[model samples]
Target chain A: MTSPVLTVENLAKRFPTGRSGVFVNAVNGVDLTIAPGETLGMVGESGSGKSTIGRAVLRLTEPTEGKIIFDGRDITKIPEGQMRPLRRDMQMVFQDPWSALNPRMRIGDLIAEPMKLHLGLSKSERENKTVDLANRVHLRPEFLRRHSSDLSGGQLQRVCIARAIATNPKLIVLDEPTSSLDLSVRAEILDLLNEIREQTHAAMLFISHDLGTVKLISDRIVVLYLGSVVESARTDELFSNPAHPYSQSLLSAHLPADPAAKLERHVLKGEIPSPINLPSGCTFRTRCPVAKDFCEHEVPKPHHIGSAEHQANCLRIPDGGNRIAQTETA
Target chain B: MSLLEVENLRTHFISRDIDNQIRVAKALNDVSFRLEAGKVLGFVGETGAGKSLTAQSICGLLRPPARIVGGSVLFDGQDLIEMPQEELNALRGDQIAMVVQNPRTSLDPLTRIGDQLVRIHQAHTGGPVTASRGRALDMMQAVGIPDPANRSNAWPHELSGGMAQRVLIAMALMNNPKLLIADEPTTGLDVTVQAQILDLMKGLTERFGMAMIIITHDLGIVAHYSDEIAVMFAGTIVESGPVREVFAKPDHPYTRSLIASTPEKLQIGGGAKLGGQPPDLYNLPSGCPLRTRCTFAEDVCATPPTRKQIGGGHYSVCHFSGALPEGGGPQ
Candidate 1:
């Protein structure tokens, strides 16, 4: 088998509340991998540890445990000083364009900063590259001189993309890149991201709460719940036949354009429990429709379903649910 | 009579420079719309598409440097644009309230959540603080906020993003306003929370027999919730109609493109493509602002077009009003 570009195993992160309270386990044992040129999507609700996992992979926040192997190198325990060079290969695009950027810096310098820092380019070379990156993202070169405050939300996002791509990174973690943008501009940004991937063959860890967008861009999908990977499969397979009860509920809640599609809106009775005070067994057992008494005693392991490539963290799949019938039916 | 009528509403920002540039954005250029007592009008458009401006104008909250240049804002048989400042202020929270997108920014960071709620109620209804607090607590409960009494005293930062937005809605409904302007209230919210908030807004609007102006860029959202929808492009209402009629058959090129671009409608992996950047508002094109990006632009488009009625309560401002391409061709 070909080696994956980025690999993560049982990754976890915990933050000290510092108030004598229990520590907050932001990310709890998430295992994922992305091959070269693959767009892997991580979908979850707020406080589901999706962003925490992304940060852990980048080593931005210190991880409490687990392994992060990037391109044959185990980077989990690497010092911050040595990790600087590795950052050149892995870049991140933040969600909020407004706060992510420095308002005082001009757009040209913002995009050029990455080039100057990592690429060792001269002044004129950096300027030319900045304009080139802007053009790629459909931002006019003339606007590079403008400050972040002057540009609108869509323009600022384009500038953010230009900065992320400036370093020619192999894997870019897109953290809700288009969520803040309006629909018309969002389509444009999605197109630009696809174009960049096609042109550069760079992998992407596309994290978003938007299912529609994830289904469009991601080759494969990972469903997270309360800090655990409940399911992972090919995008089409996962959307068509979601195995986990939480996945089913999430998909059912999505409002499709067609009014005739009978989507049973399952309103989970209780609110999502705090990450600090997670339920004893199966993290999703609280909300899962098919959760049983045994589910409360034992955490579900990743049971292989559909094909060897597909897996789901649900005991119901193995307990006479007819996994073959459900997985193949879609 | 229509419950609300806005005629030739134009909000312009006066330039601070000595040149007296008078940067008249014409945010609402001769825009006209009517809403009945219990109708939901959805304003669907991209950023700087004048949807926000139109909402803020209706609320009479356009900040300094930006003022109503020429228009008549009639609400419930009263002309709001010409009303005195104090009278308008009284009518604002009493008759018209807005639920903004970011509750954190809209809410006062310094004040306790409960205190802010009480203040809005007292200012609008002139009620006692204790009585207002009781009402505020009830309102918060109605919006599905858990433990309203305890949570009310919590600071804005203590609440999650979804919880903060619910608080904003609670404040907006303090006086049971006749019209509620929800300006992308669920834009930043998660889908599940978004669905909950949207349901709450819809239920509250119906329960109070209030007219709602839901400003959003998501077509699916507008289609699901709005009875009427107005598609804006470059400070102009290109198309306005009943939501079903507009979605079934969009007349304006921009509106058609906007609807087609929605991912849910398109085949998977074949998302609709909208070309290039949105035109700069400062240096707008000669005639149709969308001509640059529009696929069916003609010489007549540069001559400007006017709204033409296509059906029941449906209007499109296009030279090719009924001549829009089938299945969104070429654009």
Candidate 2:
């Protein structure tokens, strides 16, 4: 197998709650991998540690324990001072474009910041490159002179895209890239992201709560539940035949835009379990409709059901290998 | 008669310039709708489309710089526009209740949840404070707030955003008003929380047999929860009809654009794209507001679109009503 662009093993991150005696494990034992030019859709509800995983992978958050191998090098323990050079190969498009960009910085300076730090381009070269990157992402070149505040949500998001791709990063993490945009603008932004991915062939870790958008863009998907991977499968196969109950329920909640499409909507009873004190047996057992008594008693280990590529952390598959056979036949 | 009738409502704002010249926004230009008891009306529009402003105008909550210069807002048998100050005050909270967006800002950060709930009941019904607390607890329980007693005592900051929203819902339900206008209650909420809140609101509305107006920009939400859907643009109801009918055959160009633009789960490739930002209300183009970005614009589109009924109570505000392009290719 061609070495994965980025591989994370047993990653965990903890944050000290202010004055509170307890600490929050934002990410817990997350293991993920991204192939070159591939899109991995990471989905979960809010506070599900999906974003924490992204931050941990980028070394934005100090992971308590993990092995992070990027481009065949272990960088988990790399000093913060030395990690700046690594940023050229990895960029992140934040969820909130309005707050992410500095208000005082003009669009040109904002896009040029990465180039100046990484490439050390001259004044005129940097200006030309900034304008070139702006046009590449569908942002008006003239808007480069304007401050971040003056731009609309769609425009600001474009500027963000320009900034992320400005350094020609090999991998880009888009965190809820289109949630803040309006409908038309959202479609435009999605189109632009797809276009950029095709043109630059950059690997993407698309993180979002919107399952529909994720399925549209991702080649594969990783479903997270309470800071752990519940299921991972090819996007098309997963959406077509969701093996995990949590994935099925999430798919059901999404109302397809087409009125003719029939969706068997399932309302997951009860809120998501708090990560600080997650339920022991199966993390999703609390809300899983098909959960068995054994599910609530012991933690279910990951098992390959049908194919090695598609696996789920569920115990009901039965022993003697008949579980996979029965499930596939049914 | 319709429970509430808003006829040609027009809200304009004074410019921020030193001249203080009247910069007419026309936030709700001739926008009209009614809320029958036990029915839900959903408003879908892009930001700055004036759906929220229309809701505010209905409840007499539009603040300075925004004044309703035209139209009559009739509530039940009385005209709310011409209502006496004392009568309007009584009607504001008791008869018509509004759940404002961003519960955090609307909620009092320093006050306990129970205290705020009691205050709402007190202000509206002037009930006994002790009884109000009990009622507040019951309200919280009804809205699916777990551990109502302790949660009631908790400050707004102590609760998560979702919990704060439930508290807001409890306070809104305190008065048991005939009409409830929720203005984008789930804008910043997680999908799960959004679903839960909507479910709670639907259950409460059903139990009380109350009418509700849900103003939102999410097309999927309106498609699922609303009985009737209203597509608002530049402060006007561009399209309004039964949700099923409108979703099946959207007549207006703007409505078609919206239905086309919304993303679908099944679509693998590029979906519908409407170019350009919505027009500025203050400096709107002379004719159809959407003409600047519309693909089917003509010289006649320079004239304002007219409302045409397309059978089964479906109305479309488009100059070329009959020949607008049909939305296709996966939502």
Task: List each candidate's DockQ score.
Answer: 0.37, 0.42
**TM-scores, each model vs. reference:** 0.88, 0.92
For each candidate, give the TM-score of chain B. Answer: 0.93, 0.93
Best by TM-score: 2
Writing each residue's lDDT as its tens digit, candidate 2 over A1-330 gives: 888999999998878878586777677788889999999999998878999888888888888888999878899998978888999999999989999999999999999999998988899999999988988887888898999988899999999999899888988998899888888778788888888999998999999998878887899999988888888999877887677777777777676665556647566676776767767788888877777777888887777857677878777756432121122100
- Candidate 2 CAPRI grade: acceptable
- What residue pairs clash in candidate 1, if any at all? none
Clashes in model 2: which pairs?
Answer: B287-B302
Model 1 is docked with a DockQ of 0.37
Error of 2 at A130 (Å): 3.1
Find the candidate with the highest lDDT and give its number.
1
Q: Which digits, one per residue and each the tens of the lDDT, describe model 2 over residues B264-304?
A: 63232454466788888878888888888877788998998
Provide C-alpha RMSD values for all models, in order. 4.1, 3.6
